[model samples]
Target chain A: MMHHHLILRVVTKMLVGTIILFAFYVQFHGDFSPGGGFQAGVIMAVAFILYGIVFGLNKAEEVFPPWLVHKLAAFGVLVYAGTGVVSLLLGYNFLDYNAFNPGHPSHGQHWGIFAVELGVGITVTGVMVAIYYAFAGRPPPINDEDW
Target chain B: MVETIINIILFTMLVLTALAIVRIDSLFAAVMLSGVFSLLSALLFVTLDAVDVAFTEAAVGAGISTVLMLMTIALTSRTQKKATRSGMVPFVVVAVTGGALFYGTLDMPNLGDPNAPAQLHVAPEYLAGSIKDIDVPNVVTSVLASYRGYDTLGETAVVFTAGIGVLLLLSGLGRRRRKDEEGDA
Candidate 1:
């Protein structure tokens, strides 16, 4: 097999950085731009996958530890679900924006929406990263003699 | 006119990339092509003005899924050295099923029609009332989180399921053995 080149390494790093920044841009600018939580998560996942392909699976795993990714993914869902539960506890229906804040319905809604979107972003990004590590880390098959 | 042209180009690229995914013998190349398919689909979503769906597709389809696939490929097989021969019956069945699905889609609304029934329904209410109803600038977010929060919750659950599935699928006896060794040391 051909060894990975330095240029490929630099390009991969650049691409990864670019993807992350773009994800953030997409996440925050969802109100105006053509992106939101899903786009950002996918972008980050792609970046990591690129990193794995160009650098090495071990290095990619090192950068994004699997345990941490699992936690983040779980946390993302918690955040989203928690938002609804919070609204429900506040005396409104599940995910009722009016209940987010007692008096300021619109403000509460805004905050709630932002929080949920952030949750979506977190969960998706983590799950994707975890998947990448799992797949890329598969051991090469053993030979018949080794078996 | 320019937007329409760009959409056409993106659609073409998406088709080409998808075809490449099938044709490429190398598993890695196939995975990469799949990512390109996701990227192009994201572009198509943007063109169709379904930003929220586009965002989700970008993250799940292109980002996390691609990496996971690569990891799976690594664990299972690196290269497609041997071209396995398959019977034609299965291929014919799959082709016929796919063709029927394709034909079914023909009756759907034209892509990105602002005045379609879909646009006229709950979407219009969200677009118009979001400012007054939820007071959010982005109707998409408002609809997703506030009006239709159940759907968003379900989506999150799906993400959680996927994470759990990955952990379960990839973890095995050797992995546990390593953990045990580390713990003992």
Candidate 2:
């Protein structure tokens, strides 16, 4: 159904890769700069969302299925909580990174922050994309000419 | 001096955009204007040295929010209807609330005041401890991930819950309804 816009399709094809690279950069480089999980995850979701807008919802869903998105969202929360659970099992207070490295608290802190941020980034990405899919998938009741 | 000029220019444009959003009758135009407003706000946040917040505002507020709003408009009407009721009461209420908000700002410390209560409390500790504990240069990340670990866990849960709720409301119901229609057909 997406027709008549040759320019948008070409441009999006070129830009999507760059956008994804930038999202990863923001995700990992956040410790040194002004970005983190929330920002990075949203950026990551934007890549897929832009692709869906330029192409079509079906193609986007083929690349990233709804069931997978739901699993990733649930799994992300589990990763976050599982980290705390691991810490508790190691005979430390929940989420105390000192448990990760008994000798070096700072190193433990680094590992903990990384894991936690990864979980956050994953959950945010999944949730945002899932929400996008849910809204976009609704059958359009109005005529296309009405737009 | 240049910063002040930028601030004044941005604020003036921001107010103009808001006024235009209010006056615009076409819902599509209003949605685009709101995206512009968010981008302007993100820029303002950047100028205020809040780059992290600016990034979020730009991505989520301008980017995702604009897409979602456009999709919502697609499923609904494109034009706003003229108000049938008197606007005088709502106008007075809005004016009073706006005036009160402006009045409240007078008692607050100026931006970046070193002696402000916020500056004196755990913020300084966070700034200092981030380097000592997390060994991270970006204090915001360390603070969010380390000091406020439980709080972030809570935030992630909230995001998860919200996503599930939306998926249930939109796709879950819509899918079943569509199946029923197909069966009937």
Candidate 3:
């Protein structure tokens, strides 16, 4: 009787898709809008959290496996930090996008930011999914015997 | 005059909500009130034109954090023991520390001043040229991912840590089928 309600599942799935699309818009349009990596990341995570709540932890894991999430989250940060390290190796200040290109600093900055935002989005979504799985799979109370 | 009245009302509500958090005996009610407090604070941030901060506060503080806290409380305890004064020294120290932090805020830039040091520095450069330079419409994204990518990388690392921590904590306990069968046996 305490299982996830059908309405909750339907509503949450709809909301999750909407939130993901919104996050995509925000991330891509962040160069001119109020949205940024942090906001987009939070919104992206929210979708996974909603899904976990509505569909159950096992189902959530099936969609975003814990192992895959772990690796993807780590890879995301690595992609971001690796960009900076590459710049440093190229003989510029760490994270200096200018070093990413031999010319046109503006283009370099654009490319760098885009890559980093993608990384942020990936890490955010993955970790949020992981958190949902963690909290969801927590052992329920030993009182289910009454059912 | 209306703006002044609105500010006054907002301030009063903030204070009353803080008091409500302390006064509420029910843990669930306190958690709900805390979410309201976060939403109000996010609104205050928006009024200050710190839209980015407002968005984050709304999503994290009011949304995810509240739900997480409620889930934790459900998994843990519904009723809390009455507070005792026998070991209140830490509370006093933390209160004093927090008060000191609040006092330090007096030195911060006046709210919404476009000429504030924060706005005049790298932020302005980013705001003015990010679109032309980055080919993106949202400057916040450009700054976060490109101009200040190192910091974003660190934030992602923090997220990675959280994920790992969750996996480590929950892995063994998740063998629920085996546990259930063993329990039944």
Q: Is 1 or 3 the stronger prediction by TM-score?
A: 3
Shares of reference contacts reproduced by the candidates, in order, are 0.74, 0.86, 0.73
User: Least accurate stretch of 10 residues (summed lDDT) in model 2 chain B?
Assistant: B168-177
lDDT of 2 at B70: 88
How many collisions between residues are there in candidate 2? 0
What interface RMSD, in Å and to 1 decimal, does model 3 have?
A: 2.5
Best by DockQ: 2
CA lDDT of each prediction against the hidden true structure: 0.77, 0.90, 0.76
lDDT of 1 by residue, B1-185 (tens): 98989988998898888788777788878998898899899888878777677767766677666766665665576567664677588889989999999999998888777888888888877888888867767777677777887898898899779777866887564688999999999
- Candidate 2's C-alpha runs over 4 A off are A142-147, B174-185
Tell me, by lDDT, which candidate is best.
Answer: 2
For every model shown, what is its TM-score relative to the native structure? 0.78, 0.94, 0.82
Docking class of 3: medium
lDDT score for residue B125 of model 2: 86
Residue B52 lDDT (model 2): 91
Which candidate, 1 or 2, has the higher lDDT?
A: 2
DockQ, in order, for the candidates? 0.52, 0.83, 0.52
How far residue B136's Cα lies from its native spot in candidate 3, in Å, is 5.5
Top candidate by TM-score: 2
TM-score of chain A of each: 0.85, 0.93, 0.84
